[model samples]
Target: MFKFGNIYIIAAVAVIGGALFGFDISSMSAIISTQAYLCQFNQGGLDSDGKCVGPTPDVQGGVVAAMPGGSWLGALVSGFASDRFGRKTSIQIGAVIWVIGSVIVCASVNIPMLAVGRIINGFSVGICSAQVPVYITEIAPPTKRGRLVGFQQWAITWGILIMFFICYGCSYIDGTAAFRVPWGVQAVPAILLFCGLCVLPESPRWLAKKDRWEEAREVLALVHSHGNADSAWVRREMEEIREMVEFERQNADVTYFELFKPKMINRTMIGVFTQIWSQLTGMNVMMYYITYVFTMAGLASDDGTGVLLPSGIQFVINVVMTVPALLWMDRWGRRPTLLIGAFFMCLWLCVNAGLFATYGKPATGNHNAAVSMSITGAPAKAVIASTYLFVASFAPTWGPVSWAYPPELYPLRVRGKAVALATSSNWAFNFALAYFVPPAFANIQWRTYVIFAVFCAAMFIHVFFMFPETANKPLEEVEQIFDDTKPGAIKYIGTPAWKTRNTRAAVLKQERDQLASDEKIDAAAHKESVNA
Candidate 1:
């Protein structure tokens, strides 16, 4: 068996790019409330209470939305990069892009420059988002794949957590230094990721797909079998991979258009909608506009500490909750985990909406006064508690599952393109939500939770009906689940793959034993006949 440590190391290094993704998410939100950031970029000056009156709703939306727009372009192009240059190389390229973007953002003097920098960073994040999971899935052993791939999500949360605290610390600084310090810190992860990738092995599956069998075998031996090139387990796994690759090469002309075929369309939609639903869950709303939520909840609207405290709590909850998810995701299956998470998310959203509706007052056109009085005491505390619960529910479910599911659905032929499309769908919807939230809060106030609550309800239905159980299945076997004409296909799709895999493994062992017995008997007979 592979050394588990090596597997984690590889996965960890590859997923550092996810840190950059998380950093960007929190970095903007963190600084938006700072007087320096607002005075530099926004039109209106500081209010009577000294809170910086910032960009208009439309401008704010565009600035916040720009990264996802860039991410969309980055994700679309990443498919080609992954297919052409290889997954490792694509990730390295993304790291370089991220550093470039980080510099621009750190040095930005105007809103346009900041937007450009965010777009660049967004592009880089898109590349990482699409390729990292695919690379992890291809390299990880079947039993450990879910948790291994889930590392990206874990890194993402860690990134958010670190950036949140960094921004909090930076809040003490006056002038442009407040924002610049946090913005500049992003380069560290990007650099480390690039260096890490330089020393790592290329994905064995990608090597094998290109007919580089010897190289692929070497990688699999080193990575999966602890340098035992002749180990039966490694041989068996390599053989299966080779056969699958050869079969696809001979039978199918793989292309982007192949994803649209009847056999593949359902799987494609499953990938796309998984991401769409993830963005609609209002997780980013919390990640991006949490200060606003806290403000409305009766926390100090003007103090950075008010935003920092709840976000720090969120970061802790996100990290803690994900551990159980990684532990249980393979056991519980993707659909059930996602379904349960969505149900709770809906419930929490409804509770949040109700709390806000009951206790929250309408904005009086004075930003500071409106938030300062709208919430307080027991009702305010309940709103904060519900927000945490919502995050807790999502951390274990949609947060990681969205990243894990898409790569598992498509065959090798179109896997890169399919994931790219799915990731783009994520960014597209993310753009809509990120752009919409500021205005949404501006216009609808507490009612915004109601919209997300409805979306959560819809997502629950979608997962129950459309998503099949993929946990513990080999990538090849997962492909078979889509074949309608295959006998017992319905049962295969509906049931957890782990159970079926166990049964199949047992049957195969019995067959092997029986064949060995027959061979021994035949050898004994031959010896007797020769002696006679």
Candidate 2:
């Protein structure tokens, strides 16, 4: 009897690290716009109109960009850590880092302190972001891998949403408590993650790679087969894992430089660029500086609570829409969903650029009542709606797919290194955008959306030509798609070998039967040789 319950528990507990990732996103986004944070860190002071004036574009960009700078370092280090320490231990280390970072952020009294804390937080996020999907993919059944790995993205969105509300509630406070309360609360999830990881089993594939065959067999049996070590399903799966690991050990030494080898470069590029494209989608700009977007869209610049409404809406939409995407991902396939999402995101961004160009006003240095009330009508609402539409388009597609895709792209030998490289690309671009958006908004205004719109269009063409479908394919089989050199391979990029559940079941049955036959033949040959 197969038991899914243990796998679900493991995934659920493991992905709490994602909540910390989310909390940092909304927590900083919320604070940067608050009067208390502005007053403390940005040299903000009361103007003639008695309203707070926040940090200049460069300062704000540096503060926001600092996290990903640390994240880039963290992502690079995580590959080595996960490979050496194991996945569960790597995640636990990240959780400890997160709690410490959160505490630092919550206690900060100045800009440097806050930046340091955020960088620490970013480092932890980088580790978790790289490891969580790989761990989940390694542990999950092939049929449920996409959905299970998807839980990381789901938790991230939930963390962002929950923190948005927490910050909203804090905005009512009079002083630094507005930011401190929310920052401190993030430690809760980090603590949960640290505690939970204490009991979770290490990834069986990782254990097998380390030549711990007995432990890997026991873990596979525990997770996949209700503790039945003799179950055919467990036996066949372990045999497949052992064969792959042995072949890798004999054929290649896992190294970062190996990822650039000719045979591996295509998969490496796919992983790296997929992550780069994900950051360029302008989603984080919306996430990190939503208040600024609302202000430009004609919402009252002074109305902190009102600005939060869109963040709230974005959170709700992200949570709601991601479910359908998860359900449809394995069924409809990865390539089509990504292609469709890029197209729609391009459409919405174009609309946003047009609306902002038509009705946009420059952001004043200080919030003014008159400026706030200047343009309140259809144009503002259109910009707001278009922003929501863009989020709606992304939540189901790029948001989740970014986290899910890279882990499945590489073989076990280089999976950690490949994912780290890809994830580092994500953070590198993430730093670029986080640094660019504030100044871009200040200078070009509406043209900012135009830049993202163009990127979205380019991404569609890239996905169509380069990305192959990995949905519903077993880890070993996914490599074959890239290895294929047939003339019409591009045309079949989005097609899966086993298209339905029944077909997949039939294929697994055949493999199991073949394995049993091979075992019998080997046993007979060994017996005859010994007798002779």
Candidate 3:
């Protein structure tokens, strides 16, 4: 009944979905090295000397990879859920699933049970991750769209930071409780998100497609005009949405096959690859496996404090750096932001690779085989700083842009499904990398950074050649940029049309003014007819 009308409040509330993802990230990252976790889950348990060597590299990788594997399936289904149930309802469903998954995760007694619980939790994340951006983008005004959708990424960082510290604090508690407490605590945010969704409005575009025209107009007015349905801005937006929805209705028997058609394939490719590239940036390596990286850099200690504190600092940097991107995303535009981010990320990864290769040596210390090589002193410090810089590069750029971009590339008829497909690509790659990185560390050592650096380089080239500018354009206009038939369209680069700021607002204002002129002419004609 008390729906949030302010765009910022809506964004803040909806992005709790993203925070669920954040909670999962740190829940394991914070506790995997602890004695309780090692004893409870690792196959070998403690070594002959009673050192807390956790699971073998492959086993650990499987445990970490489980969530994303489940997420891949959940993402594939989210499109149907959102399209049929509505975005608000779909996110609510995800919240409920997260609570169930968290409970299972908290109650697990062994590795198989743990993996199963994480898989369930990952399913919820897949749904939330795919739909939160779509809901935010639909409600936000064009000029502020990027900033608002960017909130999802910001929420994710906060979730990571808050949960990491919670786990850090709990680490001091005696066995079992250290990890169980944080895993169980993850359910709290899901509860909040479920309750929050009760008061959130469904996407106005979704309302329009359902032929609930008056409801759509009211929602638009509520979001953009303080409940004034007669406002010109609201009217123009509703008109654009109605026209687009009407046109799409002609071919609205939407299927995944539709996305591969010539008119839509470019966006589908861009959307899917954009998500893939985001994971390949290796930011998640720093988030999920940073402790491992730090250990390899000779930062591990018996109590785990050495790596935990620095990992905490990286999460802080991630949260702080995202703020500016949310503020300036529209001004900077998507293509330039991604290109610049990829370039800097590549640079940082290269520095990390060179440092590790140059100064690292085979480990003989009390470390897991996963950390086969160790670097100390100056080179190790450089490795840590390089990781920080890599995160800084990704936080404001690929992190937010990747989530916001895909949902904006589709029509109302297929947005939920298209974004689901794209997000599944993200999860697929996420599963592979999460599973691969631990073993990679064991086998290749310094070459892990080299692989990611190469990915960042390829991503820079891809963004430059394939991604067109989408910033400040209405969702309806984005498809035209990919349409070769459109007289002045551009896909590989920006067109002259998108050069100006607030382009959507400007276009809407012109249309509003023209509507007034036409209405006045028709009124005058009707008056002359009555007189005659």
Candidate 4:
């Protein structure tokens, strides 16, 4: 067995990518309410209320919605970058973009400049989220894979928690500095990542695809094998990748549109559904709008540019709730954990919605009559509990698995493109929710959460039907599963669905049989020595 620390170090590399992903999410959330950051050079000066003077409701929504919309473009580009350049490079590139984007927001004297920075950061976060888990899952050993990569989800929740706290601490400062402090805080980790990523070895499997066998072998040995490994083993892996890609290439001619081919239809379905399943769970909406939820619940009040709760304390509490899941997931398996989490998420959303529906009332201080008159006292406490439960339920399941599964489900040839489409869909849907949510909050209030509860209920059904157990299978084996559906059909791939499916099962069984043989041999050798 390998030492635990080395595995952790390897895991940390991937987690840092996740960290950047989380950092942007939290940072953007922190930045959104800061009117100073939203000030416009073109719009002249501050209003009588001392907020940015420019833009009515619709125009302001556009400005607020800009970054989430830009994420669609980021996810689209990540597909090509991860599939073409390499996963590690995509993450590194994202780190650089994140730093640039963070600086733009923090330094901005007007809303337009902050908008540009937000878009840049949004792009980096989208790409970082898609690429990090794909890289980590590919590298981890089967036995510990779940535990290690689950860190990504755990990291994200903790990141959100920290950002909330930062927003809280920064809230204590008055005026422009209130917003700038939290925006600038993001630069620290991102700068660290840009420096740190340069030291990491490229993902070996990605290198193998480029025909760089030696580099691939060296990387594999560093991260995977226990100290030393046979070169033939490395060659064997390359051969496997070559066969899989060549098989996919010969069938589809390696074009991006070939993802829609008859054989790949299920693979396509899995990608789309899993992504849909992720966002539909209501996590993003909650993440996007929880501060308002908190405000309505009596958690905090507006302090100049942002809300005033102790964000750091809240983040610490959130991390404590989330980090435990990283340990339990492998013990429980992906499906059970997801089912459990979904039930709780549905429950949380219902309670949260119900509380708002029943008892929500307006506050005395805030500007908008709608918000000012919103729920106070016990109703606020319920909202706080609702936010906690929402974060807790998602921490172990939907959050990480959605990020983890896409690359595993698709083989190398189509993995990049399929992931691109899935992430793009995620960002597109996110843009819709983020765009509409604040308005929904401003106008519909409790009804907004009622809608989220409905979406979460639907996701529960989809995840139960479709998510695969991809915990252990290599890409070679995963491709063979798709190839099996057609026999000679893997060549032409127009065979009956029944026939192609049987092929997938047979190939997987063959791989399992080989693993069984090795295990049997080891057992026999141990028994023989004991008898002697």
Please say which candidate is ahead in lDDT: 3 or 4: 3
- Candidate 1 structure, TM-score to reference: 0.90
- Against the reference, the lDDT scores of all candidates come to 0.82, 0.81, 0.86, 0.65
TM per prediction: 0.90, 0.90, 0.93, 0.82
Backbone clashes under 3 angstroms, per model = 0, 0, 0, 17
Q: Model 3, range 457-529, lDDT digits (tens) per residue?
A: 9988887766777777878887667665553342433454234234545656765786687567657867888
lDDT of 1 by residue, 1-532 (tens): 2323388889999999888888987887777766677778867666667777777666777888889888988998999999888889999999999999999999999989999999999999899899998899888866677788888888888998899889989888988899999999989999999988887888888888888888788888888656867656567778888888988787665677877776777788889999999999999868887776776665644554567777778888988898887886766668888889999999999998998888877655445321332677898889899999999999989988888889998888788889989999999988888888887777777788899999999999888766877777788877888764443233335454333322335434654785576556657867888999
Model 2, span 181-212: residue lDDT tens: 99899999988888887778899999999989
Off by over 4 Å in 3: 484-532
lDDT of 4: 0.65
Q: Rank the candidates by lDDT, best first.
A: 3, 1, 2, 4
The candidate with the higher lDDT, 1 or 2, is 1
Better of 1 and 3 by lDDT: 3
Q: Evaluate residue 244 in candidate 2 and report its C-alpha lDDT on the 0 to 100 scale.
A: 86
Q: With candidate 3 superimposed using the best TM-score fit, by how many Å does residue 425's alpha carbon deviate from the native?
A: 0.6
Question: What TM-score does prediction 3 earn?
Answer: 0.93
Q: Highest lDDT, which number?
A: 3
Candidate 3 backbone clash number: 0
